[model samples]
Target: MCKAFEEWQEECIQKGEIIGALKTYKKCSFAKEETLKNIITDFSLSEEDAQNCMEKYW
Candidate 1:
């Protein structure tokens, strides 16, 4: 069986971290740009990866 990203919930897993960050942004008042910046900085994700993560998770 193939497990999905949503099924793998933990900060150690990059997928989970991205989901958590996006969910947190939705609840918080932080701006999108700031959130993206933080995601990139915190995860060391590339600009394109960060944007894609935002699109999928946000």
Candidate 2:
């Protein structure tokens, strides 16, 4: 599920759907530590930024 969300998020970004991607992330249920770490690395986000994203969403 995490992998699927990550791929969907990337696809949304590529299609110029930033809001959609964020909304999807906000709805994610499998965002565990490893998943969050992967998200941070995949998006080149800072740890603080990733944490903030998780906090805002989950």
Highest lDDT scorer: 1
lDDT of 1 by residue, 1-58 (tens): 3456555544358788688988998789788899999999999999999999899888
Q: 4-49 in candidate 2: lDDT tens per residue?
A: 9999987767434323445565567544576567657767778887
Q: How many residue pairs clash in each candidate?
A: 0, 0
| Model 2 clashing residue pairs (backbone) | none
For each candidate in the order shown, give its overall lDDT on alpha carbons.
0.84, 0.63
List ranges where model 2 is wrong by over 4 Å. 1-31
lDDT of 2 at 24: 63
